[model samples]
Target: MIRDVAVLALEGSHAFELGVFCEVFGIDRSDDALPGYDFALVSATGDSVSTRHGFDVRTPHGLERLSSADLICVPAYDLRVRQPDRLAHELRAAAERGARVLSICTGAFLLGEAGLLDGRRCTTHWRYTDELARRHPRARVESDVLYVDQDPIITGAGTAAGVDTCLHVVRREHGSAVANTIARRMVAAPHREGGQRQYRERPQPREGTGSLAPVLGWIEANLDQNLTVEAMARHAHLSPRTFARRFQQEAGTTPLQWLTGQRVLLAQHHLETTDDPITAIARCTGLGTVDNLRHHFVRRLGITPQGYRRAFRAPHNK
Candidate 1:
């Protein structure tokens, strides 16, 4: 149903991410027996724009093109710089009229600035995750995933994750068969699980002062263990009260909350990648029972465990 797409290119945009938009949607793929998308690169001022890569490109279409698009993509931007308020307003208007809005990498910061990401789930580059969370307290930031597809508004993690997000859109709009055909032509993987972790070479604890590294590493390894705030505090060699406060300050969440989140992540992985039943997954993740797991899963993900498995299970398994 998404036949028309418009990508917003601003001054100082990352050329590579913008090119990802063009490569995935701009090219005429009809010859490859794929349904072609009507794609346009539009600018705020309808003039030639210089990319961060030192190249220039012209766009005749202006903000008006965004209004007619079924989907709009805002690729990476330099968040340290200022974005025009008028362009943000136009992007918000398009979203208000039901256009699907997507952002890649630091593009999520632009969406946050436009007030579109408020109270929604989103993720940007992991390095900027803290800043995004600080700026938009309403957004539920999930830093680990390759992307977060919250329906009408979707966001991807750092650079290369953009490809996964775009392919996901293609899959949702045209079905896996068509998306796979395009991927084959592009010589890219047909699908990459969006929930996969954004790779970090060495993820350090929040502050370099003292590490919460040992506690976090222990929690991850013992996901099947019943981890409570009191237990975790003892493990970290702090009193329950001090540990609860420090954990919130350092990890941005309480010990129990973080533990529960980790368990859910583990459960999700098994649901998507394994043939295990919901009951088995519940037990494996220490969620105890299927009903309990379903309750927590739905509360966190807005989808039941079974529904998630059905949507993302490998094709052969399906």
Candidate 2:
């Protein structure tokens, strides 16, 4: 549903966050059955905008370009820099008109300046969550999550999480199939739950203790099995309590939570690529039954399994 995409190019904007928006929406991928967006880089100043890296990006579009945008990004900028009030006003106007306004990293501050974060559950980078809360006290700052999707106002946490945040919008607007295709092309994870922790002590397992790396691969390969924390703990040669603690430390979420997210992802793929009924997918994904499948599909994707298949079933399968 989102076609017109515009990102603000402000002075001292973080290059990577700006590139995240450009990568997700700006590129034309129609050859891969994914169409590009009507994208623009809008700046409050003139065509040339300086980045934090000391490079300049030229974008002829200006603030007025935001008027027709279905999605607008306030990409990360210097946290200390003061943005123009008019920019904030335009962002508010965009939200009022039902356009989704997304903020990556510290860009949430600009949204706060626009009064868009008030009464909305939002977030920023983990390091700045406290500051975001202190500045925008009315905003509910969910500090640790990768991103917070408050519908018309979406906020992403630090740098790489921007990819997750943008792909989430892509998934919601198009379907998991489109989002997954985009992810595959980018060589990124197909999906990461927005509620997943933004920070983790160990992204990979510690060298000495049994590595969760292999355990994760095993879990993925055997998703149809009835997996439990105790079972996983045994496989890791660890006590259940220790495994649970280590999982939280390493994965940034509980074991079962990660398991469910993986199950849902598999179900999404099945629904898109196969003609099998929901019951079959449920069993194959370890979701057990049609009722359970529908429950998770609706809860996680905001669409029923049947509806997802209808919208995103591959052309050959359909």
| CA lDDT of each prediction against the hidden true structure | 0.83, 0.90
Per-residue lDDT of 164 in model 2: 97
Which regions of candidate 2 deviate over 4 angstroms? 205-209
Residues 1-318 of candidate 2 have per-residue lDDT tens digits of 788999998888999999999999999998887868999999997587989998999988989999999999989999767777899899999999999999999999999989999999999999899999999999999988989998899999999999999999998887788898899989988888899889888774644556688888889999999899999999988999999998889878899989999999999888878888788999999999999989988887788999888887867767
Highest TM-score: give the candidate number: 2
lDDT of 1 by residue, 1-318 (tens): 788999999788898788888988988988876778888989988887878778888978888889899999998976656777898798789889899999999999889988899999999989999999999999999988888988799999888889889988886665556677778877876665566667743342553456677888888898888888888889989999988877766664557777877787788778767899899999989899999999988886677989877876667655
Instruction: Provide the lowest-lDDT 10-residue window in model 1.
Output: 200-209
| TM-score for each model | 0.65, 0.94
TM-score of 1: 0.65
Q: What TM value does model 2 have?
A: 0.94
